[model samples]
Target: MREDDWLAARFEENRDHLRAVAYRMLGSQQEAEDAVQESWIRLSRSDPASIDNLGGWLTTVVGRICLDMLRLRRSRPEQAVGEHSPVLADHEVPDPELEAVQADSVGLALLVVLETLTPAERLAFVLHDMFAMPFDDIAPIVGRSPAAARQLASRARRRVQGNPDIPEADSSRQREIVSAFLAASRSGDFEALLEMLDPEVVVRADEAVAARGAASLVRGAAAVAEHFSGRALAARLALVDGLAGAVWAHRGVPQVVFAFTISEGRIAEIEMLGDDDYLEQAELTIIEK
Candidate 1:
């Protein structure tokens, strides 16, 4: 094989791993794919023979790209979680790769918690904890000493494991409640939403959505029901991460995710994720009707 052909062949071997790392780091499928593509572009421009470990090189490159994107995201003020927008798909999604990602999606609750982490903290945690990258190797990517990187991961780990985003009920029941919530939402049935929510249900959204006058924190069953009534008509029943939730996909790309916190057959909390990048990074397992 020609040298270029040999190089391309080798890179293909690392595609899935690279995509997995990027998805965990960025939490968006499209962004992950973009990072992987950029890695290939970088490899194409470099002398592959000089690289001792192609996989490691590609991993770090994707990591760095994800880090930059995360930092940029942090710097920007984003819109609210659920809002009106023109349909981008403008009907159905039949992308096999997207379907595969959805089939074995990463946990939704975890991704929501991960978003709460800072860029450095996210990188450290995703690489060290999820991908099992050593802290020493991760240090250079986040521009931190190994010790600092370890600390970042440690902090992120604690938050992820103990946060409200981690639902404490049966997965199947959680899905049922989520499905009911979606049904209520699609039909704009306020009473149904109220029935599925606790008397003191809570709703949370990111600052980007809140900054645009969206409610970041909402409490009370009546109020939460009113907020969701007649919304999410475009969303489908899916597993957000491992938690039962709903996603609004345009054509095949997810535009929003409705994450829930359920307890005793009622939704205790609501997390509406509409940020474009965050939505893409989310792993959605569409449940069969």
Candidate 2:
């Protein structure tokens, strides 16, 4: 067989797996197909003799392409839900019997949660948590250290899980802590705020919030406490996506939402989201005191 023919056959062998990875990385099937095609193009240009593992090489290339695509998407204006829904080709209809099975296996809800993650965080979580890829392998792709890659996946996992199955008692405790944190912030009690936060607490803000003068990232309890101290007066206790959180609203519309990650009774992380698209998708309910 010709060299190009041999490469094409091998590429076909890995197409399904590559498509699956790309689909999960990018939540759009069309984009996933584009990424897979780009990977094949890269493979075709490279010398096959120098490649030890074509599958691994192709997967990494696709991952890098998807990462770039995700970053570009984030840079653009946010799209409203259902604005760019995927449309399948006429000849691409699936078996009726497999519809439910595919839907359940894909878990569209999980994909929605994944959309909230940053590009690096999404890559780390998908590759490490879902594909069993190690942080060492993910580090180079994300341009972070292995430890940093691991941390990204850990943070993403926490957000994705959101503890929907948390016990009522635990949920109540979370609410209490969130309430206390808000109270301390409103009262400008820096010490009280610090007490509620983990020593290594991290705070992240979505692009919109950051553009509105909020810091994109804040680390350490002291810094986080200082940032929130005397600042949540306009924010009210709320259940954000079934998790104990808070929101700041203007004329009945939420302008900012605070999602907290509580660990060992302390605030381990706080994600501030002000993106209209994200807020519209989130289910927020005010908790009356």
Candidate 3:
């Protein structure tokens, strides 16, 4: 067989697996099919000789594509559930067979839960927990260390299992961790801040915060630690949206909110919210330290 024919055969062999991976990453079957097709396009363009494991390589490519799609979906305004309901009134018959197959592959309830997770967390959980992919392979895809990838998967797993709410004891422990992080930031204790942060911790700010010259996104413990060192002196311990977090208030009115996602006793994600609309909608309770 010619090289192109051989490559086509190899790709055909892995199509179903790639489609399954993409479907889990993206809840929409149409999007999953698109992701798989894109992966095949990439494979065809690359030098096959360099690929020792085509299956693994294809999986990684599909993962990256799905992650991008998920992020893009999040960036846009959210649509209400059933907004895309089939327009059966137009006399278009729905395919019961196809619907059953899709439902059997992944339940709608689980997909709803997965949609709540961040792109990185969803990818980590789907690849490591669902597909049995190792964290080492997943780390590079999500741009995190192996340990951090594991943490993401663990956190996602907890959410997927319908245990999204932190237990009372876990909440108290998280409060202590957030308090320590605040103290370290106020005192410019960079080392201490690093200790409480995951090696691949991520910090994201809203447009309002970023407009003030703060980064929209920062990754890595060292970078995040450096950014927070000697800062947050005015930020007080608070509960933002029922999570252990902090708020920087002016005259008792919150000007900024720091929502933290803690896992494995380390801060895995921090979201800086300065948007007026979000602040107004969030339930903020300043905790007396």
Top candidate when judged by lDDT against the true structure: 3
Question: Between candidates 1 and 3, which one is better according to lDDT?
Answer: 3
Q: Per model, how many backbone clashes are there?
A: 14, 0, 0
Q: Return the candidate ranking by lDDT, descending.
A: 3, 2, 1
Consecutive 10-residue window with the lowest summed lDDT within model 2:
80-89
Between 1 and 2, whose TM-score is larger? Answer: 2
Can you rank all candidates by TM-score, best first? 2, 3, 1
- Which parts of model 1 have CA positions greater than 4 angstroms off? 79-105, 163-289
lDDT by candidate, in order shown: 0.75, 0.82, 0.83
By lDDT, the better pick of 2 and 3 is 3
Best by TM-score: 2
List, residue by residue over 73-135, the lDDT tens digit for candidate 1: 777758321111111142534445543543454455556777788988889888887788997
lDDT of 2 by residue, 1-289 (tens): 9999999999999988787788778867677789999999999999999999988888889999999988888887576424223335576665332233236444667767777889998999988877888877888899866645766786688889875355789789999999999989989999999999999999998778889899999999999999999898889999876678999998988999998999999999998888664576566899953
RMSD of 3: 9.8
